[model samples]
Target chain A: MKNFTQFQWLKYTVTNIPDGFDDMYWKKSGSLKISFIILIMFFFGIIAKDRLYGFQFSADYERTFNIIPYIMKSIILFVAWTVGNWSVCTLLDGEGTIKNIFIYSAYAICPYVIQIYINLIFSYILVRDEYIFMQLIEITGTVWSVILMFSAVKAVHQYTLKKTFTAIILTLIMMLIMFIILILFMLLIQQILIFISEIFTEIIYRLRA
Target chain B: MKKFLIMFLCVIIFAFPLNVNATYNYDYMRNAIPSQAGYNVKNVLYFGMNEPQDIFFSGENFYIADTGNNRILVLDYNLENIIKIYDKFIFPNGKETQLNNPEGIYVSGEKIYIADTGNSRVIISDFNSEIIMEIEKPVSEIYDQNKTFIPEKILVDKSGNIYVISGNITTGCMMFSSDGDFTGFFGANRSGRTAENIRNYFVSDKKKSRRKRNIPTGINNFDISEDFIYTCTENSEKTSDIIKKLNSAGKNIFSDRNLHFGDYQSEYSNSGYKPPKISDIDISENGNINFIDSETGHIFQYDKNCKLLFIMGNISGQSGGFEKPSAIETAGKNIYILDSGKNNITVFSETEFGEKVHNAVDLYNSGYYAETLNLWLEILKYDGNYTYAYNGLAYAFLRNGEYKNSMKYAKLAGDSELYNKAFQEYRRIFLKENSGKILIIIFVISGIILIKKRGEKF
Candidate 1:
């Protein structure tokens, strides 16, 4: 939007996650800040207190979506996305390092974190009568954060907008692959535990006989 | 702008896309409670009933299908005394016979159609306990051998066409002629085309074969309203199209009201438990459709236009509530609910405030909004939080050319569309009455200001 310049993502807010990444502050400042951003992202759930704010939650809002698993999934997704883009950008002769990609990508998610906290406060002031005001703010926050993330990707990779968009699309596919690998790894560990336990039981039974 | 955003959100909720509103109150004013209808009910716990499934009221009497008793009990409406126990009936050959598991009964002025389900026949008997005709399973080549004509619920139209719904049958209600001939199936529930079903149709045949096909649930009960027959089915997964209005040609006529037919999202939290099931449907003399959900035991009362009016009965099994609501039929202004689980009938008579609300709705529906406005206002006096009364008053005022009052109530109701209409009317009246005078005053003031500015410059 022409008014995109109005929003400043930096200055000690959740947007600093994306800001630090976009500015490549994670490399010079530290990767630990990325962890702080991800932690803040997780804190979106705690800010979303159960049934406390009537503006957003329904009567059965508790069961609508699991917040913990959702935040974890988001964290996993961005991690996979960073790895995906870094692996591709290496071959494409892109500019951003893996650290730069990870840090900046986390920064993209920071706006949502900041926006939800603001929304939580707004929910307190507004009654059910003024829910639309709260919802519009949430939607605006989401759209703004998406724009920030897109720009962060574009700036960190030092690529054209077209290349950045394509890279984001490929990163989604890589995230899926990463999810499958994670699930398979868990299953493999489970089978090995089962096999080892069975062998131990059989040996114990034979000796007792 | 704030109102505009809320209006959009309300539109999205009512449109019922993606089941989001199912979880949230999309209707700002549309709370789970429809009305402030506190009833003065008298529970009739009459003895000698074994799992009565259906009840019909005609004249000063009502017929209860005493299913386990293997008989139909005709009782006086006011007296509450059983007039006759129609257990023994003389056959055509002058042989005495008795009904076996008669689940449903529809009483006309002179005739009664009893669905003797276990015997697999619909017995047409007169008030004198004389057997007129017995409609057994049709003997024809077209009839499927495995399909037993076990009529669970029977509805006979004014034109001698009998519609019977059998247990576990999804094709439609079985249509029979007056002579007990199989006409065909009528008002079949249409199976929705889902992405999963479509994909399964194309993918591995074995995988698809392993999955149970989604059969349209059987129509639990049907009540004839005017020229159309309204049927209610108990499909827990789908709230859409659970209730249908079928014409003579067996086509659904009430397609516009596919959404908002029942409760959007069930509040039931018990996993693996069956969702709400609409066991019986009844239409009042004033054309209010009442649906009794057996699972939740909540009586969902909707207007003829399918707008929900009141939700009575609770699952909590209180005095006015029901253990298992089997049937609901309205007698005059009073609603009689048969609870088979409790082995009793709960009769609910509207409170003074409820009667006023009903009168207002009646006047509003008949396009006599001016007459209803006073009644709606009276309803608000009793319960200030009642939103429908506000909505009714708004519409009535709008129609009565009282635009300011209309706009005020519309805002209270959170009805944006009606608010806009009222606002438009207000604007028109204001412009028509004072536009010229206001314009002249503005011009005179501007002229004086311009002259003063010129004087200062000079």
Candidate 2:
């Protein structure tokens, strides 16, 4: 495991699953660089899924296209998931740190991220009648990634299956709470900026008068 | 001095803007795109009419139901002179009664059908103002007994079947026989399955009173063409079946087609979002559907396939614009819309672009796809962003066995079904033409693979 390169580790993580996560957890063999690259690929994969999919399957409204929402969806969700899982596991007396949770989470979704490109390519070749094959590919990839996610949590935290499930549910709740707080904070900042601008405008108007 | 002269000229040019016609059509993305005027306002007739509710053209005359004046005015086809007026009718009992705010009129041959809305009855009369028959509230067990019958619009089929659109009849058009016998409702609107309706379905009768009952909106207007009756509902709350083409069996054939009849997007105004309210519908001579939206005061014209052809007119204080477009009728090449608020008729004549589109659509609908190729191409020259033209060209190419061009136009039109069809044909033809070359390549690859295997064994 120590001798393996970042690509080799990713291959092992995809194939061996729990064993690879166990090595990363106990021996610190996981590469943060590979995890970061995977996250970037996942972001681009989401965009490609939306814009580059076949016209029949894609529901993108080209006239009202905007990139900000996609960026926010990918980056914010990734950050929140990492932080929420780390905090929840720590509270539950689990052993995983923030870095381990981030790496494992990224690695766990490798199958789904890779499946996006495959689905995009197949969408152009397959007609409407042959869409069941595409649907099967999508379902298999999603299910495999979900199973890998469960194993990753179990191995990173060194916990039983039941404890791992509780940690995951708590992590989802934590993510929701963080999202709400983040929205409220953004709204508060907006109000403060508006108030400051209004005051500055009033001062300028008075001086001109 | 030269610079000053140029500046003055620029200012003068900027001050007087070009007289651009306010005509637009929705693009493939449902965004409004400015296009050439399909129909130009030829004239606006104001013959002292007041609140004309409906208009119909038959033979060489225009029948206008002037509701405010409580009379029917018949004008010539040119709309230049009054042909006749039916204000009073002699009843069978030797009694003469004036029309009480008649809202609708249908002239079939020499017979005149008037929906006397204020009198709560439909009066069938001859051209000489002699009352032939009167149809009152339908007496049926299915019809609600407590509701009052107020006939708003009426039409007579070729077989003498009378269909009346009443104010309170939510079931559908009130069907009447030639002898004034109430048969049954026709083409009733489907009640929406809203959340409240779903909840009420599961709740007990006693507890269901807490929620409001969802009643389907009644049909506002209808026109008969051949054996089909096209109906329009003015209610904005329910837009799924705003315009329906009902067969003789009273079933909407356009239901499963997923056609959005009116504007796809709502416009925000001072009163919030306002969806299109289609007040009237008329089928043209070429079988094109022409419907008027009262909210935006625009007339939307669509081909037989429910593809939008052109959008004309709007809300303005001009001769062409409408205040309240209550009725629409197409005669020959002219479309006449009656505006109730303005109390006049605005006649619109088709332009060159419109003629080309109509010809292409007519030919395509008649299965003469190859003939429409030149017309559709000409229409594209007029408006390059016309998706219907692209679709028409795709079909034309497909019929002409030009699969590659069909695929190109179908992709431009965003018609994936047609694109797939063209692609399938292209692939089959390619494989057939290259069969010999393909076989030779396959043999060569197989021989190479076998040679490599033998060498590895050795």
Candidate 3:
């Protein structure tokens, strides 16, 4: 029973973190691939709470949840992080695979998700003056998530602190490039579809004549 | 011979050029067009007046502060003839005194208050011309002895507390007790957040106190509205509050966050030549806070809520125009604007449309929003450009529980606060009807995720 617990239950305990977690996360064998999307959804959903939490958003009525945009934003951010980080990590000779990077990055979003759910409940219960408490919670959650991301990258890639920070900065620049490219690609596809339709219409016009 | 003199005087009075009043209503575009419900000039009360600074109407009589003439001229309501001239003021010490540039006059009950500007005194007298109280420069130790107490305007509250405003004194309106004791200055102007002031953050207190702060945003004019005192400043910089509705503590409770004094855009005209200069403010009987901008000669009328309802007059120097507007006082439905430079008073009477708009605004301001809705709708038909009517419609709709319609009107008027409120109510209605279903879906999704997670682990 102890041996099974050591190998199985040990996957999520805090004792095997920083070094042990990153070593396992760098390999495909340690992949909890499904949790990645779930955590991404949570990461975006937690941020939506910022738009919802205080008088920043309109407060005429009780807030209504809109999940579609939050989900889409999370997915986009996840893709941006994975692609950006992988490219930079490859150049820096970091050991982590793209799959490991994705899983670790998503796992870092865990603190924000838990904080968001707690806040979603508290927002209804708390009055306007008590909003300082809500602000403190939000800031703490964000800071925790950010710190986790920094550590996650360092651990997964087995890189030094200086190398990790350098990679992170480069990742941000890469993210912007990838995002622009994606937009251009979508526009190109749209233009091609429009051209094809115009050609088809021309053919149909000749046939009708 | 006596009969001939009487007839001659009658002829001269009749020959006096009394302008028939012309009124202009602001179209949606805020252009003052010739509209009905306007006063003809009626009569320009120029009798025995020279360089007049202020005018007050009380007890069916016009009290003209004939500053240059150094006397308070009592004229009949029609400005046809003079009642009495209050030039000589008898001191309690049996000494004869006279006004130099008496700029302000207030007749409250049996007591008459005169701001004797040249003499630096406020003479409180009865209708019988018997001097009761004389408020001289406050000899209070706190009083800035260097600054002369040249009272330009005066107000006596119900409790007999005297409020006096002097030029170049930023300490605030000097407040005197009923017994003529200097209580203190009330409602001091706030130091504006200018670049010069921000730079003063690094400055030591001794240095800042030594330097003359840029004119200190002094009060240009003020008026009483119910229990509150409303003041307007003509600060060229748009940093500090140009207007304030202050309470008994001298705190502006009705001030919006960073309260602006007058029309947000074009304080003068579309050309934007002049800033908002409230030469005078008069409260209508219905609590409407109305004031005239001396710069543009424009009378900006606002409801008690500080929402502007109408703007009239101009500095075009034509008919229904003014060279320099000095003071504004409303008697009955007529608004008398004293133009100091032109040396004449222009009277603005309400048109039919103006009366209707006033009625709607009066109703809404006094909290009868539901009743004023139809009146506002009628106003829109005549002047679709009127922003007040749209605001009225938005408020009326919000009050009547028509949240969606209210939101639409607010959006049209570009009123974000009202729109947010209506949207909130609409959201509440939606949530009330579907919160249970929403909860079920959320729970179901979470349950599925939990099951999927357990399945993966096992």
Candidate 4:
């Protein structure tokens, strides 16, 4: 019994694990991610969009039979891209690296991937002008996006439901901060542009005269 | 085997009773459509305009502590004439009616009392809108920090007795009879998790954040119930307001202090902690106390003993839903609630079920205890399970000092966890009475044995 007790003590002594530093960093970054999204969406839309935005994917197929499918494809793509960008941005600020963004974005698009497939079947079954059915599809699509966002963040942060909620709040605050910053920056840039425009207009008039 | 059986029986009895009482029946009040008719301004008066702080209804008119406009706006039942306006207040200024942030209004006979919160004094005005008297307790003159007291709300009884909620660091509510006699004063505001600690045993822990946390939410409005005064205090962040029912002498009279959570933080983010003010509290005719969360446009209800019944509100910003309901009052069958944000009054009427219970309680309390008991019994005839009505019967009996009948009906008040403490008290008394003789016999035998042993040893 004494030898067993000593062995137990020795095992514990040998295993001195470090604190969860990455978890702490992830929380702070997750909070900062909200600010980033708000900035990109609201105030600094011009600059942040330039860095985050990419080429629009669209096609005008000339087949009347394929019109509904084509439109649905674009809508799905839009929601998928939004989910993908938001998740990648959040995780990139946390434990994710530049290369991991691609992996995280694919994971973020998981919901849209599942949703688009389900909606395709519903579209085929329903009449073309089924407004009510289409509305249900739209509402469920939005709900799926929220669930995807939550799950993607949860997967990356490795947190419990409660901690995940806290991270969401942090994200919201970050978004709010980004919004404020964007608004101020936009206002400042607008004023500077106005000043430069006036000076340029005067210079052109003088040269013409 | 015998001991195990006995223990098992005891466990079953205890556990069953506990589980049974945890569930309570919650009945929502009937939803009423907004009335466009403003004909009876005299019937339902509007008190407190511009975030009107507090209000009281007497006879036909309502006296308001119009905090924002710095004056009292009295409206008649006909909703007519925004009627007599009293601006003359003393304390801060020499203006038209020098008043500052007036809160709390109560009417007794021909006298009207106002809690001038900002000026820290109780200003009184007669029926004709004349400043009758002003009561102030000056701070220590030696320190030259002499200042009058700030009062929140006032209460008056049929005897013209006045009760004022006052004081600072050592703040407490006080009372003075109609003849200007200081009846009694009790209460001391102590430091705790925040500023509103009246009893001071609240503990705060960063680790225990999951449990329902109690902090020194600000005390906003208070009303005198039949036996106790109920005060509503908003949480530290104004997220929710807890209604604390205290005796006339200021003793907490409830097991779990009832709270009415408001969306103050969500609405008025600019004010931060200062937002989400609980503007007023009033007891309905059925002995139910209702609280108006001014920020969230919600009204909360509590039974006479301060048990929370329900919280009802529309999340929308429209007026009919009660936008910043600052003052609430009830008359006859209609409940009049004032909306400071919308500058209108929303009235709620009882549903058939509500009318039945309200009529029952009214009939019971008005010297018709037997008829009231029968009415409640009649309700049980249909539902056969009106625990609240049974509890009401228990209160009526207890008030009349009929302890036996009170205990009998109280046991029938159901086994909900909500009434566990009350039922425990009933059970305790029952056990004491049944085992009284046995207890005496055991004590006497023990005494005789001690004497015999002493004599032997000696």
Candidate 5:
């Protein structure tokens, strides 16, 4: 084979490699997996929102739980963020599929496991006294999280240090493209729905009159 | 093949839970709905071509974290959309023109900081979105020294230090120098690093399941104050979201898991009841917190002590109240709530009573001593029963060195309980000066005695 140019080499390294992104070879499956993860995240978000605001949904506790719209907003935000992250990983990490990105986005949960429990037992007890300790824990979590993310990115991209860097840049561009496409699609869908709803309402009103 | 298997196993072992002695209980806080009418929408300010994830307001302009559109939507004071596009920097090949997913947006001093989440880097640009500088690659061990970690939100302090949230949701907020140096990091789970058990909780599969399968509990959103950082956590125990106060170094000064809404218990067994979620939180310049509930469209306000002060907005139809409110902010006497579902912004003016109470606070925040005094005086004219107005007037007089006036209003602000702290400070100065008055009284008495004695001698 002819020697690859820097451009060609970079592309080969980021997307064409198989070690890191072998599973994503099945693009459709990868995308499905990501969708499922997103669903789980959404459910968890709801649970968190309900718990945070102390919403029991009881007629007795209706006032506390009526904050569903706020919870929904959080869920939507979480979905958007996770999707963005997955889209980037899939396109650039040599996986080039939504499925792999979805699988890896679960990696975020790794750090939360520690954060939640520590918060449960220690956050309140430590109070002002253990604030410094809490800060350290946070720093450590970030460091560990970085390590985990690096491994995940490396596994999916299967590239050298230089190649992985290139994948990151490419993935960003891909995410941008995907984001724009999704937005356009959503806008189109919204406009069409609005138009149809208006026409249907007009017909109903006219018939009644 | 055996060697490869061994390496894979080692990787798994390496990533295993590092902390294990931690106990987690999600049943402590009960989840339940507090009311039927729920929260009312304040206002919704809608813009951008697609889903707006994060938004920043500075001066007369608003910047959208238009995650869906993969670009930042610029808006003017009238909420009109502005165009900001850039096409520079050739990637891997000859590909150029247009940026990738610009997720998080931060504008400061003519420079815009973008998380550019897709690129796994932070990009700094001019107001026009032109690429100025970038932290594309991890140069140091500051953030995932060895692997590629995604960068989320970005913040630039008054001192110009750049702070980026990287890693995942469970980790604490990370920091970096303006020049792209990995200065330090803070705010993970409580318990020091010596407690390996604490670290284990962060990496446990069961814990992950609870977070993924259950509810999220960790630092998700944060805002910086002059001396402290206010942050919110997505808690699993169905109470209220946690509000954390951190020092300048990212150390937790105090954390209130249930910040605003009082002790609420939710009956989660029945699927009918959906608990309220705190979608986005905001802190006004004066340190008042406005947290929006996505489900009910209610905006809850809390003081620095995490006490519930007021719940603005009532459930209603259409854009008047809220369909699905996302974010909140305050400008002057108006509160703006962004209703994403209705794609409209609902605006609410402060209550007459709330406005009167805030005038004093506003003057205090803006450092207008005379003006603050005048405003408080004006408020007192309308309603003389306002204790806070008196207290505020006392503070104004104190700031202006009107001690007597300060004492008068200070007592009204509940001098013993409310202004007691400030009164003590004033007392210190009053005592030192009291000696001068005592000397004058003594001199006058002696002079009177001398005049009487001279008349007796005559």
Candidate 6:
């Protein structure tokens, strides 16, 4: 058990979810490296879901293709989810740290990343009439990941099911608050830069006069 | 000295305007691509007509409603000779009056239907210039009491049924029987389902009552085929129902097709985004629907299935372009557009590429898919980005049992429905051809599994 690799531990965590998370919390068996790899995979998975899907199923307009939005969305969403959950858990007397929350959350969404590639493959194989199968596969992956997410949060914070749900609701609210604060911060920086530039322009005009 | 000479040459070149006949059509992705000219300006007939509002071809002659001249000019089939001009007519009361701004004219058989708009009456005259029948404003209860009847366009069917479109009427084209009896309205445009209407649906009854009722835009013009009346509207706010083909029952048959009739993307102007204002519609001899946009002065020609074949003309001070294209009429292989601003009839003769596209479209619509194969292939050689040609080639290949080629063209055409049909056939053929090999593999795997089980039992 001590000599088990990170890959083996990841497999164990996926197979025996509740027991695996329990061990991660008590014995500290989970690796942050594995979580980082999962996060990177999630980023590519989001892109592949848009760009690599079959033509019939793809709704993206190729002429207006931009990769920056996809990159920003994935990074911002993942960071916000991790930080929001950590902040909520800290205020609720939960046991999980920010690092633990990030690792567990990334592990929870591993099924989603794997299923995106599977869905991309199925899109090419199935015709439009057989779209129901693709929809079912996508819904199953999302539902399974959601269940895994709930379990991971419960185990990581060592909270009851009700407390875990409340914490999740508060985390979502915290994310929205953080987004508003980010907008305000950006506007404040813009105003300050404009003011400084105007002062420089005024100084140059005075010297010229 | 050399630079001065070069500059002088540049000024001379700039002084003379280039005759650039730039014709374009939208591809499968709705991107405008410069295409081969489908039509060329054969001639511009200037007969001293002022602001002709409408033009109609009756297979023998061309009738122009010279609105500003207050007369109708009948030109020969070649459009070079003026056959006759009718400006005065004796009324039923023995009163002689000249036409007051005849805005619309339609020639059916030996009869000439004129929408004398300023007089608020439709005059049905014959080839002899005799007033056969005069249809004034109807005095029926269904006709609105407060509204004024200002006939803007008029057409007569084979059964002598007169369809009149009033400029102020939004209900539809006013239909009248042979004896000038008012029938019910025909082909009224459906009210636009806008965001405000949706909100009103959920709002309180008091608030809803306070809001003004939404009315549909009036039909600008219409043309008749065998049993259908093709109408076009000039509603800039709504794009849906811009063009409608109504049967006898006044129901739009194209309601289910979800087709966009004009330019999918709106053009930006100083005011705002300007949507296509489809002012006139005319069906050609071979069932091709031609629409002339008054705003852009562009003529959009589509096949019977609404597949765009060619887009010609523009708002330019050139031979092929028009300043204000009010009417479009097709005779034989040439298209005649009445430009009220230019005060001339710009005739567009079909080019070699246009003839090929029309032949292929006609064959495809007539269910001769196999024959259209060569024509469509040739057309693709001329214009590779033509999506309609790709669609025709896909159907031709499907009829010829070339399922793989059919799928390829269908995908290129961006027709997923056609692609699915071809893919289904290809999949069936693939499975049938490999059934024996698949069966052998399955049997070998099961046999090995059974042998392993027996060995373990022993």
- TM-score: which candidate is best? 6
DockQ of 2: 0.32
- What fraction of the genuine interface contacts, i.e. the true contacts, does candidate 3 reproduce? 0.00
Clashing residue pairs in all predictions, respectively, total 2, 0, 14, 21, 68, 0
Q: RMSD in Å for candidate 5, one decimal? A: 33.1
RMSD of 4: 24.9
Q: Model 1: runs farther than 4 Å from truth? A: A1-209, B1-30, B33-35, B261-274, B315-321, B426-458
Candidate number with the higher lDDT (4 or 5):
5
| TM-score on 0 to 1 scale for chain A of candidate 2 | 0.93
Off by over 4 Å in 3: A1-152, A155-157, A160-209, B1-45, B90-96, B192-215, B255-257, B265-273, B415-458
Best candidate per DockQ, number? 6
TM-score values for chain B across all models: 0.84, 0.92, 0.81, 0.56, 0.60, 0.91
CAPRI quality of model 1: incorrect
Error (Å) of candidate 5 at residue B88 is: 7.6
lDDT of each: 0.73, 0.87, 0.75, 0.54, 0.56, 0.87
Instruction: Note the chain A TM-score of all models in turn.
Output: 0.74, 0.93, 0.79, 0.44, 0.53, 0.91
Sort order, lDDT high to low: 2, 6, 3, 1, 5, 4
* Candidate 6 residue lDDT tens string, B280-384: 899998999999988877789998989888887788886767899999999999999999999999999999999998888888999999899999989989988
Candidate 6 residue runs with Cα over 4 Å from true position: A1-3, A17-19, A187-209, B1-20, B201-213, B266-273, B435-458
Error of 2 at B402 (Å): 3.0
iRMS, all models: 10.2, 2.8, 10.3, 30.3, 16.3, 2.5
TM-score of each: 0.66, 0.89, 0.66, 0.42, 0.45, 0.89
Give the DockQ (2 decimals) of all models: 0.04, 0.32, 0.04, 0.01, 0.01, 0.33
RMSD of each: 12.3, 4.0, 13.9, 24.9, 33.1, 4.6
**Global CA lDDT of candidate 5, please?**
0.56
Residue B180, candidate 1: C-alpha displacement in angstroms: 1.7
Put down candidate 1 lDDT per residue, B1-458, tens digits, no spaces: 99999999999896555310111112333345434554556565665788888888875788888888888888887636888888888787888888899888987657889999989988888877889999888776656778888888888888888888888578888889988888888888877568776787687978777887867777878999787898988887777667888888988877764455555553444453455688888888888888887886667776667666666666545566577778888888788888787767778787787677677788888888788887887887876777777888889999889988997888777676677677667767787899899899999999999999999999
